[model samples]
Structures are given as C-alpha cells and as structure tokens.
Target chain A: MNKLLKNSLRFVLFLLVQTLILNQIEIGFGIQLMIYPLFIMLLSFDTGVLSLLAISFTLGICIDAFSNTFGLHTSSLLVFSFLRPVIFKLFDSREGYDLLLEPTVLNMGNGWFIKSFGSLLLIHHFWFYLLEMFKLNDMGYVLQKTVYSLPLSFFLCVLLQYLFVNKQYTK
Target chain B: MRNFIAFIKHFRNVLIFALLQGIALSLYFTFVQFPRTQYLTTAASIQGSILEARNGITKHFNLSKNNVRLQKENIELLEELPKSFIKLEGKLVKIDDTLHRQQYEYIPGIIINSTHSKRENYFTLNIGSSQGIKRGMGVFSTNGIVGVIHNTSEHYAVIKTCLTKKLNTSIMLEKTGQQGFLEWDGVNARKGSMTGVSNDLKIKKWAKVVTRGGGGIFPRGLPVGKISRVEVVEGESLWDLTMIFAEDFRKVQNVYIIKNLLLDEQRDIEKQTDYEDQE
Candidate 1:
C-alpha cells in the first residue's frame, strides 16, 4: 500500500473508532479514553511539524463535530501534536530514530515508548481536562480526572498498536 | 532581511499553534450557547443520516424497557378518555375549552447520538426545523425534562442536556417552592446541584424538584429530579442542594421537542420591560 494511502486509512479508522465506539462508553470518574493522540504519535518521524499540526487539527475537528464537544478535542489534540516533536526529541535514541522505524512500541522499545509517550499523554490529558472543566476551584477535580484517564488512554493506545501494526516492524 | 527571515522561522511554529488554539477555543465558547452553523454538529445531513443508520440497529437493544415506559404512559393518558369514566354531567361545569389556547406543541424525536460523561453533553435528535423544531425549544421524555434545543438544521437538532455547565434552567423544590438554578458538577451524570435554595429552610429529604418555568422554555411542573442531599454553602445564605435526575441520560433514546406557540409574543412583551427600564 502507498504510505500516504495507508496513513489516510489509519486517520479515518481512528476517527470512526473514537467517535462511534469509544466516545459512547461512560465509565464514571472522568475517565475518557482518548486514543486519537496516538495517531499524532504514529505519523512518520520525518513528517514536518506543520503537517503534523494540520493533521491533528483536522482529526480533532472531525471527532469534535461528531461528539458535540465543539472544539475541545481540536484544541487538546493540537497541543498533543505541537508538543510531539519536542517530547520525541527529548527521548531521542542514541543513534537517533531509524528512518525505517515507525513510532510503535515494537520499533521503539517499551522504555523509550513509555518515557516519551507517557509524558506527552500526561500533558495531553492535563490540558484536556483543564480546558474542559475550566474552574480554578476545581483544580483538584481536574488533576483527579487527568490522573485517572491517563493510564486507561495509554493502555488503549498501546493495545491499538499491537493489534493493528504489523509484527514485521520489529525486525 | 536574513535576520528577519530567521525570526519568522523561529517563531512561525508558535504563531501557528497560537492561531489554531485560538480558533478552537473560540469555537468552543461560542457554539456552546448559540450555534451559528450546522456544519460541525450532527445537525448536518451527512452526519445525521449516518447516526440515524447506526441508531436503527442499536435502538432495539432497549426495546423492552422503552416499550414498558411507553405502555405505562399510554395507560395513564388512556385513563383520561371520557369512556374511562362515567360523565358527571349534572355536577361538572362546562366551560369553553377554546378559552385556553394551546401554548405548547410537542414534536416527537429519537436521540440519534448522545454523551453523558463530558463536562457538557449534547444529544442529537432525528428531528429538526423541517418538523417545526427550532432552537431554544425544550426537549423532554415521558419521565422527566431532558434539555433545551441548542441547535437545528433541516432534518436534525441538538439538545443541550442537564449534563452541562451552561444549562442553568430554573427549578424549584416541590414541597417548599424554594427556587434555584440547575447545574452539573461534571463528575457524575446521575447527580447535579442547584444553587440559591436558602440554607435556613428545612428542605425535606427526597422532596421533588420540578421546573420553575421562569424562562417558559419548559412548563411549570415538569419533573426534574428529587433532592438527594442538601448541604449549606459555607459563609452563604444558600443551600448546596444535590439532586438525582429522574431520567437516566445514559439510556435516553427517545424524546419530545417542545414548540412554544406563544414564545414570540412572550419575547415581544418581555422586550417592552427592557424598553421601560431604559426609559
């Protein structure tokens, strides 16, 4: 498959899975499972930050439209995309990222993936809950929401890669 | 020129981020109250149709429960028929029913999509302006008040349900008539809080709360919920009244959109007060 076509397919698939399936699940304690940031993560490492931001904005708006969140998703997802290169650079491998490798756990190893993606997810979740709640008095609630949702969202994103991404990427 | 080019290069990413964030945040703030476009909402044709198709299959899962509720409501309505009771024509006074002009009309609709866990939740209905449904109308189920219609398009509408920060519809305690505004605390969908009920009043446990009809978006006596917990707000004259909604929004699949026939007249009359105050 053409790389562009493949990524485009992934975009649509992620949008549908997020809007249709995951958005409806309402386990309490503000644990909203956000997996679309994983899409921003999985884009080719060489992709320009401008293209990444654009893609994140587009994806976020689509999910927002379906979910009636207006632009909350768009704003948070933009933050995720904007901070991606910064976080990835911080966790840059000894030999730098292999241009052949995708940013999946299989290619990056669990240590690198956890360190980089975990920080990014924390930033993403914190920003998302803060904006959604937007009350200074409810700072504790915002932190509670962020702390609860981060692990679930992280687990799902990793699960998605193992289920969808090919094992041959390990070689 | 080279230095200026480098400046643009360095700050361009930040500028772009700022621009996108600005657009997103503005959209969030504006559309939550008054939606100007149908594009991003499910009120749009393509998204409405897609959700409808999905609802067709999933709606059956709650078939028996919904049927029971509907059947019970039908029985209650059926008992009001003249055939159900002997006409007390000798004692009952006959008045011209036409004297009471209908002020509200209900347009039945099914929720095509909804979310309950967000800080604000909106439900997309399968009916819209085509069915005489418009913005600012009240939506309710047989069980309880659902929401106010937030936006509408040709064939679909969105309801800004009780599970939102901005849905401050007025409600009152049934027993004492103590009035307050409904607000969601954003943690639990089943529970919400009302502000402005005074602390001095002894509000009974499980006393019914119903719409106060201050805005006329809802009728005066529509069921909202029951008072589950009442706490005195510290250093205030008000009670932090907790309520459990009669309607479980998670399973709300069907609803009715209210059309106030006299809304325009009411608005026109209310505008005169502003004019009088200005004078």
Candidate 2:
C-alpha cells in the first residue's frame, strides 16, 4: 500500500477507535484511555514538525467534535507531536535511526520503545489532566488521574502495535 | 533582514507550536465557559449525522432496560388518566375554569451521546431547533431532572447535564423549603452537592429536593434528588449538602425538552424592574 494512503486510512481508524470506542468506556477515577497519541507517534520519521502539528490538530479536532471536549484533545496532541522529535533524539540508538523504518515496537527495540514512549505518555497524560481540571486546588486529583490513566493508556498503545503493526519490519 | 529570515527558519517549529497551542487552549476555555457555536461540537451537521448512525447500532444494547423504564412511566401516566378513576363524587362536579392555563410544553428527544466521566459532561439530543428545542430549555427524564439545553443546530442539540461543573439549577428541599444551587464535583456521577443554603435549617437525610423554578427554565417541583449528607461549610454559615441524583445519567436515553410558554412574558416583566433600577 502507498504510505500516504495507508497513513490516512490509519488516521480515520484511530479517530473512530478513540472517539467511538475508547471515549465511551468510563472506568471511574477519571481514567480516560487515549491511544490516538500512538497515531501521531506512528507517522514517518521524515515528516516535518510543522506538518506533524497540522496533522495532530486535524486529528484532535475530529476527535473533539465527536467527544465534545472542545479543543482539549487538540491541545494535548499538539504537545505530543511537538515533543516527539526531542524524545526521538534523546532515545536515538548508537547507530542512530534508519529513515526507512517507522516508529513501531517491531521496528524499534523493546527497551528503546518503552523508555521513550513511557516518558512521552507521562508528559502527554499529565498535560492533559492539568488542562482538563484547570484548578490549582485540584492538583492532587489531577496527578491521581494522570498516574492511573497513564499505565492503562500506555498498555493499550503497546498492545495496539502488536495487534496491527506490520511484523515484516522485524525481518 | 537576513538575520531575521534565518531566525524564522531556525525557530519556526517552536513558534508554530506556540501558535497552535494558544488556539487550542483558547477554544477549549471559551467553549467550556460559554458555548458560542455548534460548528465544532457534536451538534454540527456531519458529526451529528455520524453519531446518529452510531447510536442506531448501540442504542439497542439497552433496549430492554429502556423499554421497561418507559413502560413504568407509561403505567404511571395511565393511572393518572381520568378514565382510571371512578366518578366517586359527582356532586363535586368537574367544571372548566377560566382562571387556569397551560404554561409549559414538553418536546420528546432521545440522547445519542453522553459522558459522565469528564469535568463537564454534555449529552447530545436527537432533537434540535427543528423540533422547537432551543438553548436554555430544561431537559429531564421521567425519573428526574437532567440539564439545560446548551447549544443547538438544525437537527441536534447538546444538553449540559447536571454532571457539569457549573450547572447551577435552583433547588429547594421538600421538607424544609430551603433553597440552594446545584453543583457537581466532577468525581462521582451518582452524587452531587448543593450550595448557598445556610446551616441554621435542620436538613434530614433522605429529604426530597425539587426545582424552585426561580429562573423559569425548569418548572416548579420537578424531582432533583434526595439528600444523603449535610455538612457545615468551614468558617461559613452555609451547609455543604450532598445528594444522590434520582436519574441514572448513564442509562438515560429518553428525555423531554421543556418549553416554557410564559418565559418571554416573565423575562419582559423582569427586565422592566432592571430598567427602573438603572434609571
């Protein structure tokens, strides 16, 4: 499949899965599952930060329209995409990244993926809850929500890669 | 000029990030405080139709449960009909009186989407301006009050339910007659709090709370919930009361949009007093 067409199709699929499926499941303690950030992470390595911001904005707006969170998702997703390159740089292997390989668990080794994605997910989740509650008085609750939701969302994102990403990258 | 161009090329990413972040945060805050448009909300045309299609499939998951609740409401209405009662006192004859008039109208709608876990929860209704639904109209199920209509498109409307942060509907305790504004703490869906009522009044557990109708949005005596706990506010004379909502927001599919016929008249009269005070 053409890369552009495949990525666009993934975009729509992630949007639907996040808005229709994940947003509806309300496990208490403010634990919201967000795997759409994985969609931003899965984009091609050479995609420019400007274009990445634009794509995240569009994806975030679509999800926002469905879930009625206004621009809450958009703001958080922009932060995710903006920090993606910085995190990639920090987690760069001794040989550096191969431009041909996408950022998936199969393409990147387990340790590299875990350390980078884990920190990224933490920042993303914390920023989301902070802006969401938006009250300094509710700092404890916001931290609690971020901590509880981070593991669930991260696990879901990792599981999603195993289920859908092309295993041919391993070879 | 060359240095500025180089600067722009160097820090374009950060600048653009800031610009987009500013936009998103502004949009979020403005919409949260005051919903001005329906374009980005589910009330928009494309989103509304898509969610309606989705609801077409998932609405059936709770079909039997919703039907039972509807059936129970129907039986209650059926029992109240004149035909259900015997003419036990013909001497106290029924007569048409010139003094009374209908002041409220109800339009039925079904909720297509709802969320209780968010800081401010809004439900999308199947009815909208096409069905005479407008912003500020009160929405409620047969069991209890829901929320006010926040935004409306041609065929869809969004209700800012009681689960939201600032859904301050005026309410009064059934037994004590003390009134307060309703509030939600964004943590629990089944529980809510009321503010502004002083601590001097004795409030019993399980006492009923109903709408006071002071704002003319909801009619008087609509069921709100029952008081479960009452604690005095720290260093204040007000009572921090907690109540369990009567309506289960998660399963509320069917609802009625209230249309107050005398709202315009009431507003006009109230405006006169404000105008007088201004002068």
Candidate 3:
C-alpha cells in the first residue's frame, strides 16, 4: 500500500474506533481510554510540525463534533502534536536518528518509545481532563481523572501498536 | 525587510501553532453554549445517520426495559379511560368543555446519541425540523423531563439535555409549591440541584418536583424528580436542594418533542411589552 493512503486509512480508522467504540466505554473512576494520541506519536519523525499540528487539529475537531465536546479535543490534540517534535528532540539518542526509521516501537526501542510516548500521553490526558472540568475547586477531580486514565490509555496505545504494526527491525 | 523576514522565518512554526490553537480554542469556547451551525455537531446528516444506524443495532439491548416502562404507562392511561369508571345513578352532571383550548402538541422522537458525563452534554434525536420540531421546544420522556431543543437540521436535532449547565428548566416542589430553577453540578447523572428556593420554608424529604409551566416551553405539572435532600445555604437565604431525577438519561431512548401552538402569540405579546417599556 502507498504510504499516504495507508496513513489516511489509519486516520479514518482511528477516528471511528475512538468515537464509536472507546468514547462509549464508561468505566467509573474517570478511567477514560484515549488512543488517538498514539496516532500523533506514531507519525514518522521527519513529518513536518505544521502538518502534524493540522492533522491533530482536524482529528480532534472530528472527534469533538461526534461527542458534542465543541473544540476541547482539538485543543488538547493540538498541544500534544505541537510538543511532539520538541519532546522527540529532547530524548533523541547521541548517535542521532536514522532516516529510514519510524517512531513505532519496532523501529525505536521500547525504552525510548516508552519515555517519549509516556510523557506525551501524560501531557495530553492532563490537558484534556483539566480543560474539560475547568473549575478551580475540581482540580482534585481533574488530577484524579488524569492519573487514573493515563495508565489505561498508555497500555491500550501500546497494545494497539503491537497488534497493528509489523515488527520488521531495520537495524 | 530582510531582517523582519528572517525573524518571521525564525518563528514560523510557533506562529502557525498559535494561529491554529487560537482558532480551535475560539471554536471551543464560542459554541460551548449555543451552536452557531449544525455542521460541526452530530445533527449533521452524515454523523446523524451514522449514529442512527448504530442506534438501530444497539437500541434493542434496552428493548425489554423500555417495553416495561411503556407497558406501565399504557396501563396508567388505560385505567384513566371512561370505560374503566362507573357512573352513579343519582344525578346527571353537565361538564363544560368550551373554557379550555389545547395549546401544546407532542412529536415523537428517538434519541440516536447521548452523553451523560460531559460538563455540557447534548443528545441527538432522529426527528428534526422536518417533523415540525424547532429550537427551544421542550423534550421529555414519559417518566420525566429531558431537555430543550438546542439545534436542528432537516432530519435530525440536538437536545441540550438536563445534564448540561445553563439549560435551566423552572421547576417547583410538589408539596410546598416552592419554585426554583434547575441546575446540574457536573457530578452525577442521577443527581441535580435546584436553586433560588427560599430557605424559610421547610421542605420534606422525597417530595415530588414538577415543571412550573411559566415559560410556555413545557406544559404545567410534568414530573421532574423527587427531592432527596434539602439544606440551608450558608450566606444566602435560599435552600441548597438536590433531587434524584426520575428518568435514567443513560438508558433513555424514546422521547417526545413539545410544540407550543400558542408560542407565537405569547412571544408577540411579550415582544410588544418589551417594546413599550423601551419607548
């Protein structure tokens, strides 16, 4: 499959799965499972930041439209995509990244993937739930939601990568 | 000019990020209460139809429960029929019917999609303007009050349900006649608070609450909920009251959209009063 076509298909798939399936799962204790940030994290490292931001914004808006959340999802996804490149650079290895590699766990080892994706997902969830409940007195609830939802979302995103991505190690 | 161009080039990514972020956040805040259009909401054709199709599949999951509620309502109506009552033989009584006129009509609708946990939640209904549904019309189930029509397209409509903030429905306690506006605290779906009731009056536990019908959106005396707790406010002379909603919004599928036949008359009179006051 062409790279562009494959990614577009993945984009539509992620949107449907997130809105239709994951959004409906109402586990108590604010344990929301968000996998769309994985879509931002899995984009190739060389992808332009502007395009990345646009994609996240579009994806977020689509999800928001479905869920009646206005633009809350778009704002949080935009922040996550905007910081993706900076975080990647911060955690970049000394030997530098290879051009042929993608950001999947197969290409980038588990340790690097875990650190970068973990921090990005943390920021995304915190921003999402914080702005969602935007009351000062409810800061405790926001933190509680972020803390509980992060591990489940992180696990699901990792599980998604394993199930979907073929492990063809280049190095 | 070259130095300025260099500066622009230096922070191009940041500028674009800020621009996009501004647009997104503006959209978020602007439409949080009133939706400017139906395009970005589930009332849009594509999303509405998709949800309707999904609802077609999942609706049956709650079929048995809905059936029981419907059956119970049917029994209540059945028991109210003239055939069920016996007439006494003593005297003939003439009842006058010309003093009253019907003012409200109900249109049936199915909830295609809904969310209970969001700070501002809206439910999508399968019926819309095509079925004579309009903005500001009241929506309620057989059990209790639901919401008001927020927006509509040709074939679908979105309801700003009781779960949201600022969608106040004027309600009153059944026993004491203490009226207050309904408000949701963004906490539990089953629970909501009523504000503006004076604290001097004693309220009973589990007293019924019903719609007041002052706004003309809903008819008089629709069942809303039962008061579970009532407490006095600290600084203000008002009651801090919470009620358990009668309708479980999460499982609610069938609802009726209220159409006020005399709404235009009411609005026209009110508008003239406002105009006269201005003059």
What are the lDDT figures for the candidates, one per model?
0.89, 0.92, 0.88
What TM-score number comes out for model 1?
0.96
lDDT score of residue A49 within candidate 2: 93
Best by lDDT: 2
Candidate 1 residue B256 Cα shift, in angstroms, is 1.1
Each model's TM-score for chain A is 0.96, 0.96, 0.96
Instruction: Please write out the lDDT profile of model 1 over residues B1-279, one tens digit for every residue.
Output: 999999989999988999999999999989887888989988888888988888898899899999999999999999997668877676886577986889888888999899888899899999989889878899999989999988899999888999998586999987788899999888888998888888877888899999998797998899999999978899998888899998999888878888788888989999999999999
The numbered model that scores best in DockQ is 2
| Residue pairs clashing, model 2 | none
| Model 3 C-alpha lDDT per residue in residues B225-253, reported as the tens digit of each score | 99999899999999999999988898899
List pairs with backbone clashes in candidate 1: none
Off by over 4 Å in 3: B89-96
Per-candidate Cα RMSD to the true structure, in Å, reads 1.9, 1.4, 1.8
- Native-vs-model 2 lDDT? 0.92
Better of 2 and 3 by DockQ: 2
What range of 10 consecutive residues in model 3 chain A has the weakest lDDT sum?
A98-107
Query: What does candidate 3's lDDT look like per residue over A1-171, in tens digits?
Result: 677897899999999998878877778675778898988887877799989998998999899889888889999999999999899899988988775556998778789989999999999988988788878899988888889899999888888888889865565
lDDT of 2 at B104: 97
Measured with C-alpha atoms, the lDDT of residue B113 in candidate 1 is: 95
lDDT for B221 in candidate 2 is 92
